[model samples]
Structures are given as C-alpha cells and as structure tokens.
Target: MSDLQFDSSSAGIGEICKAIICLEIAANMKHVLFDRQTAIRLSGMSEKAYIRSFNVMQNGIGVKNTLDIKELAIQFGCVRLIPLVRKGLSLYRERFIASLPPSRRASADFTRPVFTATGFYLCAKKHKLKVNKNKLIELSGTSEDEFSSVSTSMKDLCHDVFGVSTEKKDPKSVKVNRDLLDVLPEKRQAEDGGYSSDEGKDV
Candidate 1:
C-alpha cells in the first residue's frame, strides 16, 4: 500500500478507503456480475488511478502476467460487447496459441493483446457496432496489416469452430433487357407519284 503513490491528504485517504472497500467486495463476491466502470466508480478514483492501484494489489497477491479483457474492451470502445469478445477468445484460445511460432508460444508475452484485438474486432463486426478499425489497431499496438491478418485468421476460426459465417452476403442483382428503335417522320407524295410542293422544301 505504501508503494502505491496516493496523495497524502484527507481526500486521498477517502479514496484509498473506497478502493479497498470495492476490492474487498469484489474478492468476496467472486461470482457477482459487475462492470469495470462500476467498480471504478465505487473506488472513488479516476479510471487510470483505479487501474494502477488494482494492478499494484494484483501483483502484491502473487497474481502475475494477467491480461484484463474488460479493460481492453473499454480501451477499444466496445465495453458493451465484451461478452462476444470473451466468447471468441475462449473458443479460439487453443487454435491461436497453436498457430503462434514456438518462441512466441513459449512466452506468449505479446499474444494476449493480439488475440484480444482480434476478438474485439470480430465481435464488433458481428454485433454491427460502428467501431473505428484504425482506432482498434492503434489501441492494440499492432500494425494495420498485422491486425488485418489476425482478423482474417480469427474470422476463419470463428467459422470453423463456432459455425458462425463471417462472410458478407451480397445483395441479389437483376438483369434488365431493352430494345431501342429510331422513328422517322412520314413523307407525303403527290397524286401523280411526284413529290408534293411542300415536300423537300425548306419552310
């Protein structure tokens, strides 16, 4: 607690108390449903500060190398669709891990963010959410091309594993046929088969 740099004032003390209380409740109610924003609000601290404090506590408790998908969703502006993201991650965990190179598979230091970003992007598309592709790539700390490749692989995995079709259905098109014709004005003839006086003459 002392290592966590909280302000040494009355308000800071209050904030610390609120954070501890929220943490305690969360620890006790492991199965209770709650959102990340709700916990942050209950902690009476800014989102950044709350996350920092929470990470400190998490490390103190010997919990290491954890990735918070909820926080990632929040960063990607898809907090409401976290369930779908989680489902994708859960379903594709093994396949994704297996596809990685041996070095990366061993450490998995950079796998979480890549998978999280891919899951979030897929979920956003499935749910028809208007998420910015560039923003998601930026937040995931991945290049646009890399994100695109992962997204494509994840989409295929989704189809194979979950039977969810990720291909866009094109609208049916109808072909039309028409005959064009040109019409000419009728010409008049005289009784003797000669041209009329008015015929072929400028008015």
Candidate 2:
C-alpha cells in the first residue's frame, strides 16, 4: 500500500467495519457511492495502490468490487447491519474509555462528543433511509474530523462486525426503539432568535 493508504489488506477488524459503515452512509444519502475519487481520498492512496488494496478489502470481506450501489444500500442500511454496527461501535468506545488514563476519560465525555453508530442508526431510521454524513455533522454541531473519527473507529470494535450476511428482509416488520432518539441534539433558540443547531441549515 502507498504511504497515504491504510493498508486495507492488513486492516484490523475495526478498520473494515469503519469502511463498510462509511460506504453504507455514502450510499444511503442517495447521491454518492464510495466512488473512485472518494475511495482514493479515503484510502489516501494513488489510483493504482487503491485498486490493489480495494481488491484485498473486497476479497477479505467476501464482497465483489462491482457491487451494485442500490443493492449495497439495501444491504447495509437494513436492520441486520444495525446491531452489528452498534455492537462494534460499543466495543470500540469501551476500549477507548479503557485506554484513557482515568482523568482524561472523565473530561472526554463532554469535550469530545462523537457521532456514534447508534446515532447513525437512529438517523437512518428517522428518514427511513441511509443518512448523509454532512447533514449529521451539521446537526450535531461537531467538526468533520470528529465525525470522521467516529466513522473510522466503527471497525475497531469487534470481529463480529465482519462476516455478516446482507440478505434482504421485510423491513416493515421491524420495530424501532424510541429510546435511541437521544442521539440527536434538539433544536434550541439563541438570543438572536435563530436556530442554535443545524435545524435550519441547508442539507
């Protein structure tokens, strides 16, 4: 892999999960895929190196390189993906918390707000489709890098996030948990009487 790339061939389970989730988010937005340019950017590699590592990642995850975008969305946006993604993220966060030397972890909570997997899942459910990361970041009032970090650590959770089947199911039967709604920040009015969060921002 090129120095810019993450060496997907040797990527740990967490990295794979992160890629899958990012790709899925891109698809669900209905306007983009992890297209060549974006993939190259994300991988931080030249075209040649990216293709090689892309093949490795696809082969490692048992997915085809030419996967249909619609099918990809349907597959990754489903309920099946939610639990695994959520679990993977939870595991990653646990590790993150554990790795912190007690003093920092305490302050980390408020200082470092994350766009979590559970939050992403809930956002997808809210629209009944995959969500756009831009909109999500805007809504959360968080930095893009912070959101990207959340998206990346998605794969760093557990091995179980991989090897999941993408078989389609009747989504109509699935019941959503209302408690998960807290992932979103509520709109608040500022002294100027404008929206305090992303509620009024263009998506």
Top model number, TM-score: 1
- Candidate 2, which ten residues in sequence have the lowest lDDT sum? 178-187
After superposing candidate 1 on the true structure, give the runs of residues whose Cα lies further than 4 Å from its correct spot.
Answer: 1-68, 75-77, 97-110, 160-203
lDDT by residue for model 1 (1-203), tens: 43353332422335554456345435423423334555556667755454334433433443323236787567557788877677777766555455555665554333334457667767777777767766554444334444555565566545543234755421122111100000000112223353333221101
Collision pairs in model 2: 14-155, 14-156, 18-155
Model 2 TM: 0.30
Q: Give the per-residue Cα lDDT of candidate 2 at 134.
A: 57
lDDT of 2 by residue, 1-203 (tens): 12243444344324644464346434533534334445456655544444333333433444322222233235455554555445544654555565555765654331122334224544354445665655444333333544444443432322234212343323223232211112222212223364333331211
| Model 2 error, position 172 (Å) | 40
lDDT of 1 at 116: 70
RMSD from true fold, candidate 1: 28.9
